[model samples]
Target: MNLRTNFVLGALLLTSGVWSQTGLVPKQFLSLPLGQIGPSGWLSDQLAVQTNGLAGHEHEFYHYVSQTDWVGGNSFYSTLEEAGSYWFNAMVPNGVLANSSVLNQKTSAFLDYVLSHQDSTGWLGPEVNTTKPRYLWGRYPFMFGAIQMVEAHPELTDQVVNALHKFVALANTMLHNGQGQEDWTRVRWPDFIMVLQWLYDFHPNGKEDLLLDTMKQLKFTGAPWEDVFSTELFPKGATDNMRNPTGFVLTWHGVNMAEGLKALPATYRFTHNQSGGLSRIIGILPLMSLFALDLDRASEGWDLLFQYHGRPSGIFAADEYLAGLEAVRGTELCLVVETIGSYLYQVIGDPKYLDRVERIAYNALPATLTGDFWSRQYLQQQNQIAAQNMNPHSRNPFPNDGPYSNVFGLEPNYPCCTVNHPQGWPKFITNSFLTTPDQKSLVQAYLGPFSTRTTLANNNQVSVSVDTLYPFSDTLTTTITAAQAFTYHVRIPSWVSGGTISINGGAAQALSPNNGLQAVSAKAGTTKFVLNLPAKITTGTFQSRPHGSIAVQRGPLHYAFDIPRNSTVLARNAQESRAVDLQFEATAAWQYAIDPSTLKFINSPPQSGALPSPIFDSNLPPLSIEVTACPINWNIAGSTFAASPPQNPACVGAQKTIKLTPYGSTKLRIGEFPVFKST
Candidate 1:
């Protein structure tokens, strides 16, 4: 425990590819604090309570599939299998307290069904007398199942482990047998790679042949998924090699690749195989994809749904696959859940990964959910005014779009999305803490309460206990208990500039500003960290008449100056030099008053040349002659409040007063105002 440096080259860290040699497996997953958690107690409760509904559906769906179709009908089972795996993954930790037996039974039954469907040819899937012959979509069920089984039940039967290996053999053979005619396109290779990582974990023997070779032969450039494999989307036959791949870069590639990249190196270390290097190269594709998209676009490939009338509980939407950001259209549930998974892989090794993840989690995730997590829409528009029907596959409501409806249920727009969304909640909570290979415990996110225990490379035990009302408050107290004195690294949130760190209640000097500060020493028994969050504001853009300007921000929240509704804000000459000047009367916060009636906001700030130059010299009580435009209201997503300036600013000299609040607090108010400033 009395070791100095924890950094080692090529050692396995947490989930991120950076390796650190740890004596014991990591106890916590890395989590990124995206933002605030909306009041979605419903979704949380459902995941906590009614997860069985989805599990049962997966069981029934899988049960109905005949053995003959296991090979051909693999996609159907693969879909159902993923649903079951995610349900089990999300519910298992919590289910241990409630109905552990039922949870295990359902999960075991599903696995049993998958194993039963394994073909004699080592191929795993329902080769039912369907139109298609034996395919590889179903191969992942065994691969992923093997992984979940090994992780969840390390003492799993050798037969079960061997069966999974056989399934991979079948996948490899099936892929090779059909090589003469055409290459497999629709098959998801990443999923295969992920499962292979798991399969190789238990089966360290060199007996696994085709699985390794097939993984090596797989080469996907340009599009994300192999286009030809998806017969469902293109029933006749795939003419082009590209299929519709939907997801933000971080969500699809980052997490998926992180796991593989990290696992490959670890697997290589264990098996002494060079194949791990290949996986690392494959993992770089997503990073490459990020570069492929030009940097200029704000929210580029990541599509946002912007339906006007019908909206979902969440913020962004992408139901119909990468539907560009239209305020009326909606976002996809798949994107939300997948993004969480991706962030988990990114933040473990690097602290900056926390920034992007937190943005998506806090802003994008919570924006869509209703107070409780109960009903979720597949998509939500940014400019959405109210909640409407969310029925799946409904006609887009836009003039060119179809009908809008609430696709709320186990299966909304698509059954797969419904199955995938549940993983986000449980996995997100679990990833709040992570451990490095050096056995250093890192607290990447702040979510409620949790405990983690990890062993360092020296076989020393390290335990971390985090206590705080983080995100809601600025202070975090972390208690580290170690068997021996060891140095641990902790990440500093980007939002925090600098603060005092107290070890065990004693004030320690400020920490460095590197990606992560140097290791903090654990005294004889315990080491504590007390971080004070710095007061700060963030920057954002707002719309004025001619062009938009930047707005100063504090924390995650943005601020705005309250401009009375129905006041017209003009730029005058379309340039800042000739812009409309807004009259600002600072009471508590800045307030702008144009005309009390037909309230509208002026675009330019109250400065010289903002308003028509003549109005400034007039003796008209500074408010009477201000330009008037349509009224605008500032409110949260829903709570409406009047934007009218306080008690007639025109009569201010008549012993009256005007009230105001920060622009961030006011939901609806004029961000830009026009006032004539004397030059």
Candidate 2:
């Protein structure tokens, strides 16, 4: 039979449920549609600040975003397509979550232009000449943004599906013909597969085989992620130490590793064979077994990766490539967001993944961006005490990245992070709450102030609102209104020593959590649930740091010593005051070692009736800890970077009590400190 005839027959079988029973493992929780859940409380305030800052204004001042080919401009950069795609990807979620009409309108217009300009050959985005290979990597982000836009505006669904169908057909042919299967596109094929899977699951339009075939072609031509994870080929240390690392550069790239984490799991969903019923059953056994083994190996690989190179910020060192565990080495902003995306789609449904998500979001994500969101860094260090451009004479910790990588500015070192960082918070907000496959139960997968509306089984409509300052405060209150009774599940973070939940002012019940989730039965009508998670101050050591050095944490938020700073304007746009790049230098001493035992949690009343605007502002953290510290003669590694903490450093000055704020709130801060033991 011809290919078209075979696909038609397969569609018939699928519709008849003959091929519906599959080998894929079901996810414990399914993500809700975009716009169904949104930011509230302090989280909402943060998104508003983003809207008023770089994310909302990039198109106006940033030439990469403003004059890109996607919007009919004549910018002639080879990677302009990727750059424009990144901006649109971030802006869609940010606009929808922030509810900014202006941003939404801009995103809408960009989508309209791209869709309307799709090539006649079923290609999406700008068309390169036939002689030049059309790269597929850029279109992945555009499709991601387009999906979210369609979710938010259902009226555009038909147009989006039509465009996607055409593009997928073209992509399948391209993969077969080796048109755009470059290193990046090959390594990051899971992103494209995910878009294909979305279409297969939601809007197949009776072309399920075509979608599945496209996925298979892409996977066959893609990087060997499963093999990379399953074998010893996975880098156990920094990639630079490996022999001839250039050949394996793409495999060891930090952002690719983050995005590749889910590759095997995603591939398993479509590896099912559908030739004949008995043959399919026989084929499934080996595939399932291989997938199980692959999953375990992938998990172990990740553990080893983190064990050797992980940082306290819930991200591993990767200043473009995989750096080791040194506190001074920088982690890329792209790694932070992509790691969050990987965890969200990991399919294992492990609560620890959610915990990691919160850690990266609350600390590392914000630390890279300015409080006002006007500028950001390509790389951030856990022990960052300054945001100045690196001196040429300095021994660079980030060998793979540029000297200006850690400075806060517009396109400090690369334009990729500038366009890519916007997806961090918006994705967090939307994926905060999830529903079961049955749609009967709601799972509060990640903690934050957000509200959601979902329809449960039996046509039960439910709306849930969470109110509290989480990660900063100990208490969270959830109000649920449902048309019918359903169970509400909340994830109890592993960091909490103990927690209690109360129902509508009734006596509190000690939370008995299973798999890091606490479940409560709610009635058909309105129900109120209050949870108190008392977090204790804790300290831990990093492998690459001095033996006596330690990092502090309370709940999900990391604590850092906020360094006083003087800001210098490195560059600025003449047309806009907020559009400026800045360099920061520590004004006061930063070489202080603290006694961990002296740490005491402190909570201050909100300055006003509500959380402060630009919630991550250096002076506005509502929670802090007081610790006894003493000045020490900590050395500098190079001309600029702080060296490893001295082992049991001697106090050089009289000890004094100092306050440490949340890591996300500080622009220049010390997250890990040396120990100053009293004689």
Candidate 3:
């Protein structure tokens, strides 16, 4: 019954040969081609920056050039960092084909470097780290790329599966000698499990349970993240202290926690309750629910993390550890991307999971860098006032982080984020809308301007095109092109009130959302749905800063005070490189308190377009609100916003009209504001 030391594979799978990939990947939800679900509005503009800018030239950097480094050249980063970025690099072309022309060329070059450099034994990344000092965790990203590409180009499935099979054999051989056991392997077992499961379905002669058994055995003894997620309260005793511990039972790395969040859920799918050692022991831990499976507790865990370590941007502060809820702690880019992926997995099972996805999508996902994707931060703090290299980790905040953690450059503290940030937007678009597991209903996950073409029952084709400025405006219009009538499901955010839906500009029907989904029937041919997704401002009591400060949220967006700042370009040499880094420094004071009672908001939509350009910054968020507030005597903490507001501080500054922008739009702003009792 020991899930830790031994695992028994299920006999339910077809024992004869490799089971069909179709079995694991239900045809229920079909993602349209890369070109079909094209990016529009501000999202498309961001991709344009990606295609012509950093996405085009990031590999040019020596650290990311896998061909040279994997062969003989020296690399500044571990092979895992470079290999993990393959999923992002492969997606550049998929997202950029609509706005730019260089996507295909860039993707071809990237694949050539990756596909052409594999060793005879099926190893692709740096050969040095594949099987030493425990095991290197570089193969999973290639596995991710393989899974994504196999469907687009089925001809490559054989090659992809064969290479991974050889690599897994190599890993099995190495770990069998009691040589491969480390925190990295233990914390990352789920990634390898993903590859093995994919091969089990796709490979012509998939190994069925043997491959999974080998992967399970390769993991370190009795480690990695099972008991902590047993309930809505983690640690089982969380009723006493509900804060989610930053470090796992095995390790404290935030990225591990983020990437492995879905491990238990994925396991439940592959090993449903069976009378086996693995299931017998695993079943002891309570981590399963309906469609989301273990993720219900996972979401609860995340909610607690937000309470203790989270920033207003929908990410937890963890430079290298679970940095507390201070505004100064730096949030790593890898954590941001991996957390998005984790939440996205939840959405695939059901659209209701988008409650978490929208928060990250509207706030943390887009606020990391400049309008152009040329340069980015290795770590971004919620209250950062400057972007440069320095070692403040030894101070009040995160300690494990490197000196250049918050710098905005091609390869700041590390090259990991530089190479890994591309998957954030493209994947969000591709997964925006998906059909239900039964394929009878279409569910909207992420909101924004996009299009989709999906197949319903009886081979009916439905094409949907939506035009709206979501996350900014509360209204959306959806147009459906179909020949047959079917049920269409839309997820209305929980914050929405007084919601109404109209068909073809007809009478607005009063409706109530049930479990976040509103199911309505559409007739044949053209059908249009106009929705009024109303939002209201609400406040919560938190003692973090300013004693009694409140976070202002509307719809899916949080508004923050835009801190005035100045920027200067960072040059590689005396001459400027194609990629120039812009570093910002605070120009105006950021310490201010708002009048909670006098809170007033105004809507300012774009005059013409669905949204405004420079959507994330440059002071153009398409929509903004004016609030009446006064400045307080707050202090800055080590070049960032201080931890807490002064106790019972006097409001000496004059009352002023403060214009607040969306949390994603202000690179330097305070989303969590202190309230002044007197104005």
Candidate 4:
């Protein structure tokens, strides 16, 4: 019944196989090709900064607990701080500790602290000194830190190894004594699993009697798996969401649960023939209702995310009310990052998932980061300022709508996000490139730079390299090098225009129109992917406006450019209208140069100072211009900023400047463009 202890034991059981590879990975788990687009830690950097700020934070944990009775009285702050600090350090290149010496010293010091405080029961947790020292499970992370230190710095001393074994023995003891809890299910299961599996994988034939009982309780069978498709709430006292605003039922993403189910096959294998544990857990729910298992579930979630709950930047929120009520209040940065993380796991093979992944990565994900990638807003809305400042975690006020505003840090409204959010960025960067059991690889997402060696299904080792300037350039090229033959599937993005596939300097085959990947069959030589995407644009109608034409999609993003009083285009709650005629002015004007650096916003004037004004800082980036020749001239009446520019500005003597840019490029500009046709 002890969940934490059970998880430890189950991990030991799963790690029955110990294997190492300095070369190619076997053809089992798909391996992503080495590519730059998937390597950048743009979002990951933001999360790490926040994590370091909070964990050893002066008020959050370290400093506060250090001053309280909890540090030396009844709790194990010393070890928790050590474990957290070590894991946090393992992430960064130099980390908190400058070099191997510092890392080893810190690790050794932590081990010494833990060894000095170990209770006779072999259990180590929060209540290290109490009679019921076994009651706490929070200290389990220290054991995880031990394994991490070993992994990050392989030069573990004999003393370090001996110290680690003691912690493991203590963990084993806790399980034997039944000190683990039953209600604790892993929301961050993958993180713990990585360490647990590592221990068993490295020390095969180490312990069986110690892990058997714990594995049984740790399996998904006993964990509560709810119906994620429906809006069904968990029983009042049974779960966290019952408290309202805190639970996964309403607030947690269904996609995350779906992704965990999809990854069950590998974990099942890790457990060594002990199967059905995953099914037993999944069997509790309607299989058809599982979003990852059924397409309908995906459609429904997407319907809400795209059609109803979508924001201008492409992220969706799980907030109480539908988004667009107040874009800032609805979308949480954690939810945005986690949603993508889950979706990638569930549908990595599908092109649609890749499309959504790219959209969210380029749009929603970047919206939160400051221009320099330093500070981040927990939530962001269109037509709102996006700097790091305190804002209400709950609803907003007045015209913005929702709860109180200007709140900061990890508020009670939802603090789990504070911890859970960090996992997203790191995982996102790592998983972007996956290697199929066969060494052949594909580019699932694009960031910047990274590389890994992988094994293919045929057991051939291929060094797959991906190179591209994406989000900026339309073409992405992957070069595969191997001693043998291997087939690689390259995901052709849904947004790609005139995307052609050429392998090893041969005539390219035009893959199935949009969104279909072009598979490349080649040997050890060298294959190149050359894609020529001409400038293109698509138009959609504003459902609410009469004779209004709105631009729905351009390249990979949907854009809206709203200029002042004629602001029907990017106004509050603006949507696609059927009555409007949307025309793409495919002329020279449609290709204006844009300044990428000028994408920030000007602050809104304070209420007491003056009236609400629709103005932006002149210092912001200049809009990317496109000259679209329109048939009609609405500016004959002297309106300088017409919805659409006239064929000839001289007729109206209103030579107005038309500033148009990609919707994804601007966080400050009005997105919806007004539509004007005869009538």
- The per-model lDDT (C-alpha) reads 0.38, 0.78, 0.61, 0.39
Give the poorly placed runs of model 4, Cα more than 4 Å off: 1-28, 31-127, 130-223, 231-314, 319-328, 340-348, 383-425, 438-461, 512-517, 533-679
Off by over 4 Å in 1: 1-101, 128-134, 138-146, 157-160, 178-187, 207-211, 220-317, 324-329, 342-348, 390-402, 405-410, 438-448, 541-630, 633-679
Index of the highest-TM-score prediction: 2
What TM value does model 3 have?
Answer: 0.84
Ranking by lDDT: 2, 3, 4, 1
- The true-versus-predicted C-alpha distance at residue 451 of model 1, in Å, is 2.0
lDDT of 4 by residue, 7-108 (tens): 453445345432111111122334232122224222333333433443223222332122233335333244353334333322322222222343345445
Runs of candidate 2 with Cα error greater than 4 angstroms are 1-24, 67-80, 128-132, 244-247, 272-293, 342-346, 541-547, 607-609
lDDT of 3 by residue, 1-679 (tens): 2332332221223232322222333322444434446667666766666665665555555345433453342442245444434533445435344443444544544445555666675555645445544344666665676566555555767766677677777777765655444557667777676667656744737465567556445433323354444333343211222344423344445677676665654444443421224333455432222112233444555555666666656677667766666566777877777766423343234443466667777787677777666667777766666665553653434466666666667767676776677777776776777676666667676678777776777787888888888877777899988778888877787778788999898899876666677876877898899988887776653324334666777777777887888878765522227666667777987777777666666777777865555578757776666677777778755554366655555677888878777777676677767777653
TM-score of each candidate?
0.58, 0.91, 0.84, 0.57
- Per-residue error (Å), model 3, residue 575: 8.2
- Candidate 3 root-mean-square deviation in Å: 5.2
| Model 2: per-residue Cα lDDT over 1-679, one tens digit each | 2223333544465457644654344565788888899889888989888888888888776777774443333442233368778888888999888878878888888888777767788876555433545788888988999999888889999999999999888888877676877779878988998898888878989888788778766665566565455334556667676752224358678899888776765765665421223433555432222233234545665676677778777778887778876688889898888877533333666677788778889888998899899989999998887788888877788888778888898888888888888889888887888887777899998887999987888999999999988877888999999999999999999888778999988999999988888998889899999999998888854323534688888898888988999999998877667877889889999999998889999998586646787878687889999999999999888766798888878899999999999888888889888887643
- The superposed Cα distance between candidate 3 and the true structure at residue 555, in angstroms, equals 1.2
